[model samples]
Target: MSNEEKQAPQDQVEDVIESEVAQEDAALVDELTQANFRIEELEQALAEAEAKAAEEKDAALRAVAEMENIRRRAAIDVEKSRKFALEKFANELLPVIDNMERALLGTVEDEAAKAVIEGVELTLKTLMTAVAKFGITPVDPMGEAFNPEHHQAIGMQPSTEYPANTVMLVMQKGYLLNDRLLRPAMVMVSQG
Candidate 1:
């Protein structure tokens, strides 16, 4: 009950309070460290997720570009198919035109066959008009310079009236469908 005894008990209480405060500080520091580690793990996970999303986005864009290219190519193919669709049919009708032309040439001088000739001429004119509407055009290369791409040389002849390598005569006229050659013109080329 003296002053020393009283001072000793007070010191003991102060030590106990200091010890509790130190333990609490240590626990708080440990919790803070664990929280910092967790935050770092979460940030790394977020970065990985962002990288993966970027990769997927790039792949999706590439796929879309490829699809667009394929669509464009398909459209071009369809347009080409539409343009050349009548090539085969026009080819088959060429011989009929040639035969009609031959018949007309033969019957021109006959006076008695005048009515028949007129009918045939009218028919041929109608046929020509019909074919022309469908982009079927004749390649009559008479007097033009010989183009091997459009005219096939059946034979060559010497000519003073035409320049060298000119198309002097067409044996069989060619036909075109949509500016594309259905058949080459059979021609006689002039020689130098």
Candidate 2:
């Protein structure tokens, strides 16, 4: 109704509007700060996830490489087995060499017997040549110290010629296929 009363109402309205605007500005600032912080946190999390993925990929590649190496080694082992398959069969035929040697040295009566012995000699030489190609060497320790690992003690005899435990006489010869001993020599060991 009066000028003073009308002015008071208008002033109260302006104060209320200013207060509301201030509160709205403060809320907006707080929301923007929170959103920026959340974005930074998300970026850091993504970086950590990417690093973990890279590490896992490296481990998987190493595992695959190791498996490939193992497979290659196994292939080599299998090839070796196939190459050495005839080892056992060759070892069993060693007695034939001894028999052939005996036939050559034994006294023969007639010309026919001598011819047969000469034929056996040719066969023995051929067999030895073939065996040599396969890395099979004869373990003929004629004058060497007798090792029980390579020689079998068939008899103990007194000998002034040989050292103690040395091979005085090799009865049946031994053989080796590679580094492995196929058969030990049947020998006479000199006693101390």
Every candidate's CA RMSD: 3.4, 4.7
Question: Candidate 1's error at 178, in angstroms?
Answer: 0.8
Winning candidate number (TM-score) = 1
Clashing pairs in 1: none
- The models' CA-based lDDT, in order, is 0.93, 0.86
The per-candidate count of clashes, in order, stands at 0, 0
Candidate 1 has an lDDT of 0.93
Q: Which stretches of candidate 2 lie over 4 Å from their true place?
A: 1-44, 47-55
For residues 1-192, write the lDDT of model 1, one tens digit per residue: 999999898999999999999999999999999999999999999999999999999999999999999999999999988888888888889999999998888735677688888888999999999999989999999999999889999999999999999999999998888888999999999999
Which tens-of-lDDT digit does each residue in 2-111 have in candidate 2?
A: 99899898988988888889889989989999999999999999999999999999999999999999999999888778656768788667778878877778888889
Q: Estimate the lDDT of model 2.
A: 0.86
As a TM-score, model 2 comes out at 0.70
Could you estimate the TM-score for every candidate?
A: 0.76, 0.70
